[model samples]
Target: MTLLLLLAAAALQPAVEPQPSLAAKELRRIPAEEARQGATAGHGSVYAIGNHEIGRYDAKTGQRVARWDGDPAQFPHLNSCELDGRDLVCAASNYPNVPMSSQILWFDATTLKLRRTHSLGHGHGSLTWVTRHAGAWYACYANYDGKGGEPGRDHRETTVVRLDDRLNETALWTFPDSVLERFSPRSASGGAWGDDGLLYVTGHDRPEMYVMRVPAKGSVLEHVTTIALPTDGQAIGWEQGQNRVLWSIERKRTEMVASRVPPVK
Candidate 1:
């Protein structure tokens, strides 16, 4: 009789609603030989980022304007970049190497020349992506579970760190367990803050981007939803003036793709 009563009560409870699935509409694909790692857009141009190379192409004509190649030993792994004002701010790291170190590189947006570099030494995993938002800098530090991971830290250690103008850590937050599960064996390879006040991140090779929000008072970011992307994840950047547009890369095809992301409800 007690079992029957419990079952009746359980059936009366409300059902859990499944998370919504969203898709990005692919707008265009431009051939960018340097689109090996990630891509960003600004100043009527799209920049294709490689480990040690960057190719600037006219967005309208799809013509390569200029390219910059760096010494691999010096600028080993430039994971991602975003155009900031007149400079292209990039996040670089020494990955697949222990005691992971990272740095921030600033380059001339128009000239595609190395302007300056800020070494982050070795601390919060490997800096994979960084962007300026709401008067502060948000950076994603990647911690792998296998190849590039340290002895102790693994994928769970991947974090989003907020820093001041001088690049000093202000606060930090980890990903939720659900999101971490998707990043297992690897980590977040790209991230950016959306105008809707949500944070979007991508795993090493997943074709999905996870949307999250910083909890009111917690160390773990709250998972909002996942959006399907047309390309495998690496690094990404929001379109400069477009409300819901983003630029990403298709590594296998060596192309830079532009997509219009749907707004989160």
Candidate 2:
């Protein structure tokens, strides 16, 4: 009876299919000094990031508000962050060394203080970015042939994994080879779920973001579109309010920038 019920439930699920591409327009750039890794927006504030540091800023005025320094031995590389309710959840990894490991760092949204740490012991590359969608947590576990990733796995093996609220992976999807090829030696650096319900990913040092959706029949995610941005990619965030904007950081200048779909005429 249980088997019959399981099969019946599965039959009612919708089959996933490829989605069409769409373009995002560039709006403006915000000059900043703490955006070495990535940026995100929340609660009238913006968070600019470095590998081991994070700073809070006024979302409208771009003024520095607060900053937090992470321990090098524990939180060496903080690739990106997402605003979850009253908490800022960030992805951190140990890079430029063997046996790569990663963790999730949670911070208080108002105080910008480290609140908790959850380790995702060594497996499936380095955790680059994390976000929550439809009650599940999605994390990008990136790989590379370069200095810091898994030694044997090719850079093409990077994956995005969906985890339950407890951080246990439930489903996984890989990027299309065409997308992976664009990264060359490095792997995916940032990811976020757009307001349109598609997963947007950015490659290392590239000013492009790839749109992807999970396919029903395979482990590979379907490629939707490639949207251009102003700066080389690191991490990204999607602002879902009336602004409908996308945010990123220019690592070289430590600048945070924002872009949005052009307003309809």
Candidate 3:
């Protein structure tokens, strides 16, 4: 009787596919080995890339498009990515697999084809992603001292790179120690920008997020505020409209939360 019941339950649910949501939701969920973090737009379209492959999706329309291997050589580990004009810029790194090394890869926005890959050098580090501001593209990364970002993985600083419209790095800005201290307790995690002209980053240490003003006419950024978050907060970003809306993603539970970041009175 128990066996029969188990069989009945199994029959009710569809057989698990390589990526269930990609097929069910009409949005390609890149292979886990290839993608870890993703970004979406207002029209139900999302860009999923990381690890070694890249995919595009339209959740509502159920269109899942993928490029077999975005960058196979850099595969198995891309921490984060973002859309730049008509390109997908990713921060490729060896997290637990390989320590202290990562690179940036550029792909054509339409076909999801590889355009160029830049070696960013070695350091126990992971980049948050890239975004456009003042007609320039930028990406941020956390640098650690030890392996797999172990507890001993002392962070020296966070970096921001200026890229061309084609997604190539042209200039770099390394936040100084004073600016890094505001994030006193380092938690090398996700980050995003706010319409308030602030950059928001998350922490693994506790249920909290921090906001800092993008330095004006300077290289070092300044911390402005810290917001409380749920325990499982894994990634964060801000979407600007009437006001800057802040979003937090709890990956494990597949949940997300949004809040507003308003102007200073």
Candidate lDDT values, in order: 0.92, 0.83, 0.54
Clash pairs, candidate 2, are none
List, residue by residue over 125-219, the lDDT tens digit for candidate 1. Answer: 99999988899999999998789899999999999999999999999999998889888889998888899989889888888899999999989
Question: For every model shown, what is its TM-score relative to the native structure?
Answer: 0.92, 0.88, 0.62
Name the runs in model 2 displaced over 4 angstroms. 1-23, 262-265
lDDT tens digits, residue span 183-225, model 3: 3355346666655556666544445655656666676656665
Clashes of each: 0, 0, 6
Off by over 4 Å in 1: 1-20
Best by TM-score: 1
Error of 2 at 173 (Å): 1.1
Off by over 4 Å in 3: 1-35, 59-73, 97-99, 123-125, 149-153, 161-186, 204-207, 216-219, 229-248, 254-265
For 1-265, candidate 2 gives per-residue lDDT tens digits of: 9999999999999866323244466766666677888988867888888889888888878788898987888778899999998999999988766688888999998788999999897888888999999999999888887777665787788888999998888999888987887776898998988777788889887778887888978899988777767779889987647466888887888788888843221
Candidate 2 structure lDDT: 0.83
